[model samples]
Target: MPNAIPTTELYLIAMAIIFCVPYLIWRLGRTDYFAPLVVVQIVTGILLGPGVLGAIFPDYYQFVFTKDVIQSLNGLAWWAVMLFVWLAGIELDLGEAWKQRRESAVTAGMALGMPLVFGSLAALALIQFPGWIGEKAQSWQFVLGIGMAAAVTALPILVLLMEKMDILRTPLGQRILRYASLDDIAIWAVLAVVVMDWARLERQAIFIAAFVPACFLFRRFMTRLPERDRWYIALIWLAVVSFGADWCGLHYMVGAFLAGVVMDHHWFDRDKLDTLRHNVLLVMMPVFFLSTGLRTSWEVGGAVVFLAAGFLLAMQILGKQAGVHLAGRLLGWKRGEASVIGWLLQTKALIEIIFATVLLDKGIITSATFTALLLMALASTMLTVPIVTPKLQRMRELISRDA
Candidate 1:
């Protein structure tokens, strides 16, 4: 491998292309209705990665994503995702869910449970085909991992979409957030369960056993600090917890979420936190997306990957719809409400990618499987605004007529 360009210069060039190309396409192509800029960014990542662009322009791909360049990019990707996940944890409104406990529990449970069951069934079928299951994963782990990945609500991306839809402050939106938040908790817990290493079970046990008291002490310490100091302190906390979780075999992402979950969302200013998230997404997360794309493969055959992705998407969409509709019937929600909620809840992107990435990292799933899930998540997320926008408009019209 001859170095045609300085490693640092190539990295800068990669970063420039990462941000610029995606922005131009997203702005010029006007694909926001079906694919938000973030979605476009993800798609671009795949194209720039080995599966597409590298396949087409092998020499250029090698020149840009060289080993050293990739390492530098990976460091940015890791911190970016951790910060994003931590922010998501901080945004969790469990207290609000507790207030709406009955409604939240029923809706969240069904919304999550149905897709999980459906996805696990899909996993079972895929496992029989070979090249789908991870080498290190058990039958149960692979099944549960796929199921849970399907059930994920991508709370952070949910917030972004909801805000874009102008529903973030609405009662209906708050209701949706509560359900997603509860599901988020369940998603991570299930991940922890799936990744549990019996050989290191004692270490996992010790980590959990110690984490509680540490959280309490940390919370108390955070409370005493000035708000200005909290942000800096929290990053330090994120690093520590993430390290601990990885050390215990749970993975750093889980630790990142746990670090955020225990702290008070109100501890930091909401607007500033939102700004921080947006900045990370704008600056750092593109690297994550690119890194994610670079991992995509079609070794199972492109046709098989697409077919599997289609099947999983159908299962997730139908399963989520069925579950939400069931809850609506039981709770007596108005007509059209369930459909809208179901579509919105089915939105998956950031968190789903993270979940799939973690599974890939743990050798619990093959890259082919990851690629399928990636496609599924992109389609799932892209469908959200288009599907829900019209429903929301009709909902408002109905309210107007009644008034």
Candidate 2:
């Protein structure tokens, strides 16, 4: 016992391995086409977690991922996700969505509604089997939570993907962003409904009542502060809002998003905000992914987890494509437009994971269900570039040929 590595040393060693292994795999394997570095990191996390590597190497897993080390990692993961989610909220450009409200509403609604319906049906199937429903969830909660998870557009990741594809500055990409922005607001609002605690209704109501005035005053106050001072104040505000939401049983992540959503993006420099988001992902989000992987379970068996993942992924892709195609027809979109739009909307990486994390924390979904959704998210994201790139290329060739 005296010869054992100290907790601090082990924690540092674990962090080193967490970053190094995934970087090496991503670099050496050259999986940027199907599995990006972030996806590789998430898979590595699952492998390092109790289900995979821990199953094979019990002593090493126990030693490195000790209760203390995990606690340390979790604290890092918590703040990392909060910062990421907060940035996501601030990035939501509803003003643009409003300018294109007619098209945005129709596309966003069908895109969200169809997948939600499909995912809910899948949820219904899962609930009939044991180990799928959470201990505290009612039937409605579990169904709606899973449905919304399917409907998530992962606006941040979509932005990243569009940037890589060189379409981010194009008119089509801007249009896609408008539709996604509307869905982003709807996603979190529905989540608020799904996670609502009737027992704490009085407290939640009070929090909402207080938050409106506080938000207004906070915005006014922030506008009066110098830029440097504003950043510091924002962190303080993030903490206060997160605490209030958690206290009212709505959860801290919801509050974090709300905190950022109400604040004007112009309050900070756009370049600085972008850099901060990039740095957070580079430095801290891997920790969140690892912590998430640690929560994965196979009590219902690994095969079942994978099967459920495949089913949900299929439903998500098909349903989203169906919905977007329907919208395309209704809105008189040209051919090939819907395919590109559908694939882009299907990119659900970080947001879906965050949403599922909240659901798991609230006991609205069990670990087995969370694992399935995690796998579904990873698979869904991996498919985006490969599927969309060809569609985009073919469309370009067709246009050029016709010209």
lDDT per residue for candidate 2 within 129-207, as digits (tens), equals 9999999999999999999899999998899899989999999999999988888899999999999888999999999
Evaluated against the true structure, the overall lDDT of model 2 is 0.93
| CA RMSD per model (angstroms) | 0.9, 1.0
Model 1 Cα lDDT, one tens digit per residue, 1-403: 5796899899999999999999999999999888888999999998898999999999889988999999999999999999989989888989999998999999999999999999999999998989999999999999999999889998888888999999999999999999999999999999988887778988988998999999989999999999999989999999999999999999999999999999898898988988998999998999999999999999989999999999999999989999999999999998899999999999999899999999999999999999999999999999999889999999999988888
TM-score of each: 0.99, 0.98
Q: Lowest lDDT 10-mer window, candidate 1?
A: 192-201
Please give the lDDT score at residue 181 for candidate 2: 85
Please report how far candidate 2 places residue 53 from its true position, in Å: 0.8
List candidate 1 stretches off by more than 4 Å: none
lDDT of 1 at 170: 98
